[model samples]
Target: MPQEAGLRSFFLAGFECATQRRADGKRLDLLASTRHDAHVAKDYARIREHGMRAARDGMRWHLIETAPGFYDWSSVAPMASAAAEAGVQVIWDLCHYGYPDGLDIWSPAFPERFARFSKAAARFLAEQGDEVRYFCPVNEMSFWAWAGGDMGRFNPTARGRGDELKRQLARATIAAVDAVREVDARARFIVAEPSINVAPNGDSEQAIADAANYCEVQFAAHDMLVGRLNPELGGSPDKLDIVGVNFYPDNQWVLGGPPIPLGQYNYRPFREMLKETCERYGRPVIVSEFGAENTARPAWLYYVAQEVAAAREAGAPVEGMCFYPVLDYPGWENDRCCDVGLFGDADANGDRCVYAPLAEELRRQRVRFEGEFAAANDERMTPLRREAS
Candidate 1:
């Protein structure tokens, strides 16, 4: 298998690994609830057959660290061993918006505790081996702050503390990166944040100004991590390594209003958004989370993949794109079946129902890239590139 710098593959599968508390004070473990935790080895092997050799999975902080300082690797070991057994690489997410009980987000101990947890996780994974090292210390910091703090939809449920929560998350993330580095200096961190575009409804200058400001808010977490917004967070250029951006159909909108439908006149160009992100961060990027529901999956992949290709062609250091939530997961709010994965729920044999449309599209894209995706100077890839092919 070939690699592009820190990534093992140009395409990757991402498991839906969100573990958070809901508004009603109920905990949601999508991985265990979906039985993904039970079939990590099988899942990794199967996706490798689909031509992807890398994945993004998460560690359940709440589950692993049952007690304050004690941890049980029983929950995360199987996945790490499975990836190695299958010869697949992984990018692990340390804190996917969930924390151990009795840990207050507002307390001074939150950052310290999270950092300690990061060190423990890194040490354990390093013991597993040296092949798998990429990590997202705190996944979706901006979204977490908004959903959990501003909107009061999840843990750390505070109605008017979005900025405060964001700052806290940034501090924790920077601390985690440093902790992981202490364990393995070779480890790379991918700061996964969402990319969004907002526009004004009318011709009013104030409306345009408001929309622009709202649009820039999407970069707050990243900016803070890079010490551009909040230098007090201990963030610097070192903390801003690989940029992992999540984008979706609902990511764009009229500021403070309705969503801008994908492919419509009001929708902004994703290629431009990607380019701007690379320009702003000065790091290689990965579309860490992107997919649509049910029947729209294929079309969405096609659109996103093309935009990613265009971004690469335009000289943005886009390293890879991950088909997020490669396995279908239960919705957090309603427990509904979100048919947005290449594979549906597993059966008695631990086999999942394949979404044929998505599988076919994935193969088609994979074949094309494997046979035709060489760059001007990057020769680590196989087959001829676009112009040559």
Candidate 2:
């Protein structure tokens, strides 16, 4: 079994904190949409009730840094304070696809300004009495690059500049890590990137090669961060600390084809994927973001937890699993409800109704992990007992 990854809990909750601009120039504040910002104290307390003592949350750069070189913590302090009070260890995302209004993402000033913001944020968190800090400097760089830079789906809205945007994000991530370390040397960083699998549509050589190449693209941001691909970007091994693999039900697909259904021959088992990621980076792995919609929630969690356990048995240091968007929020494109969380939308009194089935599954998995950890501890102490005898 794998050792604990220093988190307060093996299972974590993730609040959707995306603050990105849409293609039509509309800015999204998912934190506000989910009412997590207003009801964070109750939200944190609720997760703790479910036995989750850690979480993945975010700060809105666009809201915090309204102007150049000035940051107003009014938007973040309440959430941070709530987490501290609830005894939840949080991995805060510094950037989740949004930036300040006047900051040009393509210019050199982008990374410089981001570094300063990161430093300030770190200092502020430390001042709040957080001894150990975990930060995801820039969330999902690979996905962000493809969506915003290549597909023009969101902010920056550039076409055919995916690689360029990825490199820029990598630079900013490295700079953020350095800046944060200056304030808190014990700070750990998580690089959250989508974990995907692409298979061939047909047996043709061209199809196979295309599928393989497309699958390889998922690692570009991670590679750039560790100097494995781009040494000039100031990437080093330490910059890529914990590999936060964000997998979803639709993460695997045939190249240029439809998504591979679970249990299909073309669909890769998540355990194999986790093992591959661990071997590649040699870093502690965490399921950074994962959950399914509506009725599929419990089944999806069971599948992921089982696969994660299998991977750990195979010598992969799989640490933790996070159920992302633990609170349901409005869909990005349409304002319709996306019923994908363990907790439903907040009510008037700042309360959320828990989805009983998913919550029950989480408790079951937590008990199983606790048993495994205890067994592993006993195995480790056996030799010590013999020595003492």
Candidate 3:
């Protein structure tokens, strides 16, 4: 219970945990994958197997409460039950992107649909009692809208920022969170938003401002959802209870330097963000998602833990930091899967494969750190860090 320093994180897994691949070989994330329900079950089974303390599981409102008045959560319930039995805390995510079969973004019934589904889900879990406390009403609201509608990364791939999409998503999230609380007064939320960085190619002042605005745009929906979009150029932080920060080894840049390789980004910003978020919102923060690609993962976990500890010491209310997954799945790039595993891999015959050394080292570091982290180094406070694995 790192609750005192407000440090704790969910053990998130199953982005495509049970999703089957598209026939043409393209794939969608957890939400869009038709195999979501099955993958969720398998992932929950493994979560119990590992004795993980907390999990970031999702319940897509669009899927469960389609057709306005109809409700169908038969699939997600068993996983919630399993978590309760295992004594693991559940940080349920209400939406990760994607909508129902026939719903439009601007449908008049959108808010009510989300609210009803969220309340039902919450009541269902509350009846189970005590085990599920945390909730993420919507995961990465800005990224999803951008990627799906504007950026064309996922479904409904629309281009450019859509304020209407943003508002609809925020409204649904607010309604869902509010609905859940009605069922369980103790429900806590960690609203996740991907922290993106888009630095300029040159060393001009305009580049600096562009980079700052890039970051600001990433924070917009989160700001509005939290009730901070009005006064402070986006000064709302009410709908957000615990600011859910998702940083990755791939999410970084150089002001004028070469891009760091995918696996080499540092944890300095994570620490700084925790401190700043706590100071700004006066609420606990959660490193909802954090991990690296394919090398020196043990060291990655070690440094992340160290950074988390450092944030806590500095008076940042960090609730928890999560390791994305315990194992990897092959064919990740093919859209069938993504290899963000923390454990060593094995083949169909169960033999050790790539990243064996990294996995072993991760175990060692996890043991060595023993849930402890260091304070943020004052000399290293400036964002440009020199440390490398």
Off by over 4 Å in 1: 1-5, 372-389
Error of 3 at 10 (Å): 7.4
**Model 1 lDDT per residue over 57-129, tens place:** 9999999898989999999999988999987888999999889888998887999999999999999998997
Which pairs clash inside model 1? none
Cα deviation in Å at residue 62, candidate 1?
A: 0.9
Every candidate's CA RMSD: 5.5, 7.6, 7.8
| lDDT at position 39, candidate 1 | 88
Worst 10 residues of 1 by lDDT: 380-389
Can you give the TM-score per candidate against the true fold? 0.93, 0.94, 0.77
Q: Candidate 3: lDDT over CA atoms?
A: 0.59
Candidate no. 2 TM-score: 0.94
lDDT (10s digit) by residue, model 3, range 1-389: 22332322233442423222233435434533323344444444444433345677667655577577677877678777766655556677776664565656567577677777788888877777654377777677786676655765554555765655676678788787778878887777777877655556566899778767766676777777766663322224446677777777656665545554444543235577667666766766777777766564656766666777788889777766666644555453354444555433333433322344444444344444343332221112112121222
C-alpha lDDT of all candidate models, in order? 0.85, 0.89, 0.59
